[model samples]
Target chain A: MADFFNIIFSVDFGYAVLRVTTPILFAAMGALISDKAGVINIALEGMMLISALTGVIMSALSHSAGLGLLGAVIVGALVGMVLAYFALNLKTDVILAAIAINLIAMGGTVFVLFMVGGDKGISSSLASKVLPRIDIPLIRSIPVLGPILSGHNILTYLAFLSVWVMYIFIYRTPLGLRIRAVGENADAADSVGISVRKIQYTALILSGALAGFGGAYMSMGYVSWFSKNMTAGRGFIALAAEAMGGATPHGAMFTSLLFGMFDALSNSLQTLRVPAEFIQMIPYLATVIGLVIYAANKTEQIKRIQAHQNREARKGAQEVKLL
Target chain B: MFKQKRLFELVRTVLAVLIALIVALVTILFASDEPGRALSLFLFGPLDSLRHFGNVLEMMIPLLFTGLAVSIMFSAAQFNLGAEGAFFLGGITATSVAINQSLLPVVHPVLSILAGGLTGALFCGIPALLKVKWNASELVSSLMFNYVALFLGLYLINYYMRDVDAGAMVSFKLADTSKLIRIIPKTRVHFGLILAALTVVAGYYFMYRTRWGYRIRLTGLNSSFARYSGIQTASVIILSQVLGGFIAGSGGAIEILGMYRRFSWQSLPGYGWDGIIVAILARNNPALIPVGAFFLAYLRIGADLMARSSDVQSEVVYIIQGVMIVLIAAESFLAHYRHKLVYREARKTAASGK
Candidate 1:
């Protein structure tokens, strides 16, 4: 217990939480946007895996992290477009299509990795460029907080900033309103002159780009090399976080931080005598528990609403009886 | 009209397969340095010999079970994808039973297989219970449970079943008498194939001939209507998922017993996901699952052979699988032709009525 406290209370642990949260934060944001726009992009896992490979390969070739990011985003958007075409136009089941995309990404990445003369499991031969870390100017002067707040990958700050940006975009922008409108009721949105399909396509493309950043960060910001299946269900965790946050940017940030804390704890626990598998199971178990609680609360709230309506109806019946 | 609809389904399946093949070939043409050699091997490798044919048959065993499992769940509208975890856990649990040398020789494998199926049913029942009680989405919950099951399974193996003398992370090998005897002399083909075939027939009969099966179909097609019609939709849904889980779990046990001497899998074997694809291609019909499974196994073995003999990567099969699933699942891909055919049939029916 003392060792646990020491690990949790340290400044290094704080930094680890922030660092680990970056990928999940980006994915949750992406999931939030697409889910709000009426499409649940379960293909986020595949998108992230593909982009991780793309970002590594591009960075290796061009020696520019920026170019690598651009390539990843483009590839992600192309995948999103494919999903939209199949689901919206061809009338395919969205979930099935996403699964296919994921399978393709998983296999395609390995195929390309081998073709590029790299190990199927790891892309260590490539000298991939990593995103630069930035030290916050004013915050670095502080003693205890400096290390925690400063010297993070630039993309980490961008991930936090995106929450604010997403807030403004979702609430203040007309396009965001249209997207929400379509999500709530597509026929209603169409009646009001908004093209539901077009809005959904746009939402998916944007969502893909956000997820691409998350993927790129896994390879370029978190590590300078790509590994096969490195995402390791982070995409699904992000979706869970999004659901936990009620598909809002602010809520997603908080939930992502919670999951990030669990992840960091898991990492810390690895040094202890505890078996690693149980620690690794923490985040996934948390998701299941959290979702169950949320669903229970929702059910309770619905029941309460029904009971109140019943009481109101009884009261009206009694008044009529008195008359 | 029913005949025409069946014809349309067949055509769509053929078209989807052809498109996937063309796309896979084109991918090879671009990626492979020795495109000619790779393409030829990929196309004809699985059919090269009897041994190759046996390889496909061996691969089909696990898929057959998982396909039937997924087909049952899909027909009941459960969408519980925990079969992956069920398969893994089933194998592990059965391994625990099999490694015990004290059990009766004849009943050891049977008991182990039963334990696996029960464990799988229990694992899959969590999501079903959640859905029944709280109305939670099974897809997400079941997916999350898979990871939990994985970690638990690993912990079980590492703590209780670890064989330190064997390779790292390996379990103790099952007793020789407990292992399933291979049916074929040279090949890995075992008595499990007969069991798998029987499972498909049993599954088909259970879903189509029984009153409970009728209720399950009704619930799947229209749960609200079924509920209104006093079908007890919740129980039907829950029961089907439990049954599906059992089928998948047994498949895992059978595969391990018939093939490996020990539980050697490090992660989910992916037969669960492949089951989904097979289920889709089979149109959720148990009778067709074997055919779909065989076709998939053929493609996979062909890809493996190509990878071994040439410059082509086996991952190319994923590209084909992904493309094929999307195209096949796209219900409206041949909408124009389907509509025209239906129109012609409807006109003829109208004339007959007149």
Candidate 2:
């Protein structure tokens, strides 16, 4: 127990938290955007998986991390557009379309990997380039905080920076308001000349791009190589975080940090006497618990609002009777 | 008129399959050194021998169970994805029961299967309970629960059932009494196929003939209307999900006992996701689930054969599955043709009446 606390308080753990949180934060923000636009992109998992491999292959081939990132984002956005075309234009169920996308990504990645890497599981043979890490000069000189916050992967900083960008984009922009309007009531938005389909398309594309960054960070920054299903359940966990955060960027970042803490702890605990499988279960278990709590709170708030409305209606009736 | 509609649906499904196969051919051409050989093997390999055909039948059993499970759950509009978890947990539970040395001869497998099924029901019941009581999204909750089930099952197997001398992370050999009897002489096809068929018939009866089924159908069609009609839509939702889980669980147990000598699954078996494909292909009809399952099993076996015989990977089957699903589920895929047929049929009906 004392050792556990020691590990938790160490600068390494804090840095690990930030490191692990990068992909999830990006994914949650992506989920938040599409969710706010009323077309939840459940294909974030598949998109991330596809982009992760794309980043590895492109970076290996081009010898440029930036080009790889660009390729990943482009592929991700293209996938989003395909999903949009199927869901919006062909009138397919969005969830089912997302499921199909996931299946394709699962199989397609392995197929392509074997074709390119000559291996079925991992891209060890490919010489993929890793994204550069940045050191904050001033922060690096500081004490405990410096070690925890400075000298991280560039994508880690971008993951944190994106929260602010998403906040401004979602809450303070005209396009954001239009997305909210479309989400709140598509018919009302349509009547006012807002094209719901176009908004959803834009949102899904942006969402996929964000997830693409997460995927690239996974293969290029976090591990330096691509593996089968390496994104694992992070995309789903991001969806849960987005939900718990009430579909807001900042809220999602915080919830993502919380999940990241559990993830880091799970990683650290593997060195101890704990069963690795049980420790690995913590993040996923937390997600389910977090979702239930969020749902309960939402239901409670709705009931309270309904009760207040009933009281106001009775008061209005009483006033009419008196008159 | 109904027949016309059914005909159009069949046509659309056939067209979707053709398009999906074309996609597969293109993918093979790009990936395989010998595309023609790969394509021929993928199209005809499963029919080449009795053993390969038997593999298809063996694969069909689990798919049938999951397809029926998904069909029931989707029919009630409950998108519970816990069938995957339930299936995994059910296998574990059945293994736990099957390894028991004290069970009677004939009744052991039956008891193990029933226990496994009940375990699945309880496993899936968590998300349903959450959705009913707290208005949680069953889809998200079930997805999370799948991992929970996975880790918990692993822990159980590791601590309680691990056979250290077996040289891998597998459970002890199941008791002889608990092993399902082989039904075929030359193949691994066991009594599970019969069980699967009975399950399909039972599932069809339960979904189409019962009052509960009617309620579930109504709720799925329109929950608001079902609620207005006092159908207790919440319980109906939970009931449908639980039933689906039960069927999925039974399928997992049967697959294990009839197929393997020991419980050796190290990850989610993915039958649940395949269930979604099967259910979609069947249009969520219980009666048609077998046909859908058989189609998927046949495709999978062909892909497996192609992978063995050619340079192309079997994962191409997933591409085919994904494309087929998208095209079939698209409401507007062949809308122009469908509209034309409906219009022509309407005109003919009017002329005939005159």
Candidate 3:
């Protein structure tokens, strides 16, 4: 237990946590944006999966990181186009469509991976470029905290900055209001100038962009190569994080970070003599518990406040009678 | 009324098969370097080989069982995804039972099969119990339980059932009496195929004609309405899942007994996911399960052959499946199939909610 406590601050462990958190944050925020617009985005996992493969394939061919990243975005957008076409133009079930996307993406990635590498599940032989790391100048000189704060992969900083950017976009922008309005009541938004389909499509495209970046970062920043279906279940975990965070930017970030921490701990927990399967079960189990608590608390808290209000009103009534 | 419904069913089945065919043809063109003969070989190729035909049946039996499993449960509106885990564990349990109780009795295989069915049902029942008691979402809990089932199965196989003489993560060899007898020459088709078909028939009877099935279907159509009618919705949901688990568990048991000398499946077998597709294609109709299973079985067997022949990965079926599932979910095709029972009922299902 003492050794376990000491290792929590270790650099490798911290980095693992960051790595785990980064992919989920990217996907969750993407989900958050779409969901805020009232368009259910279950396709985030599918988006990550296909984009990851697209990033790998492009990087392999072009040997350029920018091209790979761009390639991933395009791939994401194409997938987004299909989703938008169905959810918007076709009037399909959004959740069902998302489930379909996830299924296809899962199968499609493995297929493509095997096609290129002639391997069953992964590709290691076709070496690809990863995202370049950035060195922030003065931040490295501060103290023990400096090492923790500075010298993260460029995507890490971008992931953190996305929260603030999204928060501003959600609260300060006219577009954000339109989206929220659309989410709140589609018919009302439609009665106004806002197009429900347009908002859903826009949110989906933006979602694809963020999820694509998540895919690129996983391949380039976290690891050197793409394995068959290597996104594991992080995309689903990201969705869970979004639900736990109550679909807010700050709430999502907090839960996303927590999920990432658990994910990292699971992988590293084996070193601490925990069973590998239990470690693997952590983040997923966390999702189930987190959702139950978050959902249950909403009802419980509302009841408490209502009870208090009733008590206050009764006291006022009694005072009036006495007077 | 019955004639119209039958015609609608016929049309839907044709459309589903045609969609799958088109996808297969497109895949073949992209896959083959020598497209002329290879394309023909991909489509008509499975029929030429007795071996491939046999392989198709072997594949069909497990999927048929799983498809029936899913269709039955989905009829009750309980989307228990735990069948995959149950099937895996059930296979292991059957293997373990067969290996240990070799000298017990003449009815050793029957007992082992029963053990498999019971364990699988119990594995699925845990999630159903949670859903009934805590108002927990079965989808989430069952998915979680899948992992538990997976790990536990691995543990059991590794620690107890493992055949030391075998190469990798597999189970011990079973007694000679436990090995299932093949029904067809040169095919792995055992009595399990008949068992699968019987289950589908039983499933159809349960879903369409029986009192308990009426309760399950009514509860599925609308829980509030079912409850108003004095149905025990919670128990029906749990019961359907248990039954579904039993069928899938027996499928796994048969898969172990008939297909190999020892238990060899090390990881997830993917029958459950395919079963999901089969259920959707059948539109959750129990009667269509056999057709759905056979269609899936053909695709899998044909793809396996294509991969082996051309060295192209069969994983490409996923892209095709993704496209297909995406299209299916879109359901704009319903406009064309407006005459169908399911499409009309689904429209009413949507309308009633609104």
What are the per-model DockQ values?
0.82, 0.87, 0.45
Give interface RMSD, every candidate, in order: 1.0, 0.8, 2.5
True contacts kept of 2: 0.85
Query: After superposition, which runs of candidate 2 have C-alpha atoms over 4 Å from their true positions?
Result: B352-354
Which of 1 and 2 is the better model by lDDT? 2
Docking class of 3: acceptable
lDDT of 1 by residue, B1-354 (tens): 888899999999999999999999999998888999898888888788878888899999999999999889888888788989888898989899988998887799899899999988988888999988987778889888989888998999898988989977878988877788788766789888999999999999999999998888889999999999999988998998999899999999888888897788888888898999899889899999999999999999989999998888899999999999999999789999999999999999999999
Question: Considering lDDT, where higher is better, how would the candidates rank from best to worst?
Answer: 2, 1, 3
**Candidate 2 chain A lowest-lDDT run of ten:** A269-278
Candidate 2, pairs of clashing residues: none
Clashes by residue pair, model 1: none
Model 3 segments beyond 4 Å from truth? A117-119, A299-323, B101-106, B129-136, B334-354
True contacts kept of each: 0.85, 0.85, 0.47
> What DockQ does predicted model 2 obtain?
0.87
Estimate candidate 2's alpha-carbon lDDT, on a 0 to 1 scale.
0.93
